[model samples]
Target: MALIETRDLRRVYDLDAGRVVALDSVSLDIDKGDFVAVMGPSGSGKSTFMNLVGCLDKPTTGHYRLADTAVERLDADGLARLRNREIGFVFQQFNLLPRVDALGNVELPMVYAGFDRRTRRERALHALGRVGLAERAHHRPMQLSGGQQQRVAIARALVNGPSLLLADEPTGALDSRTANEIMALFQELNREGVTIVLVTHDAEVGRHAHRLIRFRDGRVTEDHRQVPVDARALAREAAE
Candidate 1:
């Protein structure tokens, strides 16, 4: 079964002027271990789609199934639980706590999930190791470079072993070199059997994904599979 399946998804916002349709009957399926990138211009419903898929918001009407569970049938509490258990979110802003070190930041999710302190520490450290930031576990966000901080954010997102990674412009804040590094890390994670759906406006960033879905006027205008550019190779060439 597809890791994510949405059928006739629609979202509308009621304003004083009138109702504005943000997502207009969108439907798509993302399979397990797939790397899909969502691309669109402003107000094209990319963020709206991500929000619904990430469980941050619900669609006005549609059917959404994540790994065989009916998302549209879940209540608020159930959605929160499902989100915490199955979805990991990475945003443009690092969103790390200002006073928390890398380990603490990564452990926050496990803490919310009722993990014991010992297990939280172990898992957080393991996640940091996976992101190549184990040595910086004690470093605060302010102490790390932009790329390193993003690595910490990625580690935090993965600490819970979520079934899907939802990244919304995760590399937007980085320089080209740092952005490539982050994309390389994402590619590596996807290769290791993690499903990923990323929303990116940058064509260069989207090129790293195996599939691209472009939205326009609150609908999907294009969806196509492509040979992804090798982010790690680009990073290596930049270093050379």
Candidate 2:
């Protein structure tokens, strides 16, 4: 079954003088375990689509099924619960709590999910290890490099054991080297079968994904898959 399916999804904003259609009848299906990239120019409705998929906004019309549940039908509390359980988000900004250490920041979501102290610590540690940050777990955001801080944020997102990882320009604030490092980590996670959806306008950033879906004027403009990343190239890059 598809992990995400949408049909005629629309979001309309009513202004005093006019009605603006942010998303106009976009229909799509993203299979389970797919690494999909969403691309668009500014004002092209991609942000609106991301908001709906992330459960931050409801559709103005039509239907959306996420993991086989009708997202449009869920009440606010139901949506919140589902989001807490099934979605992990990484933003352009690292979004780490400056006052907390890396482990504490990673444990925040579990705290919201009602995990106990011991279990939260273990799971958060495992997540940090997965992102190659286990040794830096005690450092604060200010003490880490940009790449290290982003790794901590990625660990936090995964600590929830979410079914889907959604990232919006996760590399926007980083230097090319740091961004590539984060993308490599995401590629590794995708290989481990974590479904991922990333929103990016940069073609370089989107190239990391297995599939691409382009948006224009509130509709899907293109959808296609790319060749797998060359193993030798990846290894060579890793050695650099």
Candidate 3:
């Protein structure tokens, strides 16, 4: 079964001046281990779609079945529980706690999930190692470089071993070199059987994904498969 399936998903916002449609009859399916990139101009419903997929918001109409569970049928607490268990979010900002070290920040989610301290520490350490940040686990966000901080954020996202990774403009704040590095890490993770859905306005960044879905006027205008550019190759070329 498709990991994420949405049929005629729609979202509308009521305002004093009537209603505004943020997503209009959108439908798509994302399978396990697929790396899909969402692209669109500002106000094109990309963020709205991401929010719905991430369970941060619900749709106004239509069906969304995540892992075969009807999302629209879930209550607030149920949705929150599902999100915590199934989705990992990486934002443009690192979003690390300023006062906490990398290990502590990564362990926060597990704490909320009711994990014991020992298990949380072990899992957080493993996640940090996966992101190549194990050496910096004790460092605070301020002590790390932009790339390092973003790595920490990725570690925190993966610490729960979520079924899906949702990244929204995750490389927007980094320099080109660091962005390439981050993309390489994402590529590596995708190869390891992690499903990823990323939203970005940058075409260059989108080219790294196996599938691209473009949005316009609250609708998906284009969807296509592509041979993704090798981020590791690009990084190597830059170093030469």
Clashes of each: 0, 0, 0
In model 1, which regions exceed 4 Å deviation?
Answer: 228-240
Tens-place lDDT per residue, model 1, 51-87, is 9999988899998998778998899999988888899
- Model 1: how far residue 190 lies from native, Å: 0.5
Query: Candidate 1 has which clashing residue pairs, if any?
Result: none
Give the C-alpha lDDT of model 1: 0.91
Name model 3 segments beyond 4 Å from true: 228-240
Q: Which ten residues in a row have the lowest lDDT in candidate 3?
A: 228-237
Please write out the lDDT profile of model 3 over residues 49-84, one tens digit for every residue. 999999988999999988777999999998988888
- Output the worst ten-in-a-row residue range by lDDT, candidate 2: 228-237
Question: In terms of lDDT, which candidate is stronger, 1 or 2?
Answer: 1
TM-score per prediction, in order, is 0.94, 0.92, 0.93
Q: Which should have the higher TM-score, number 2 or number 3? A: 3
**How does residue 126 of candidate 1 score in lDDT?**
97
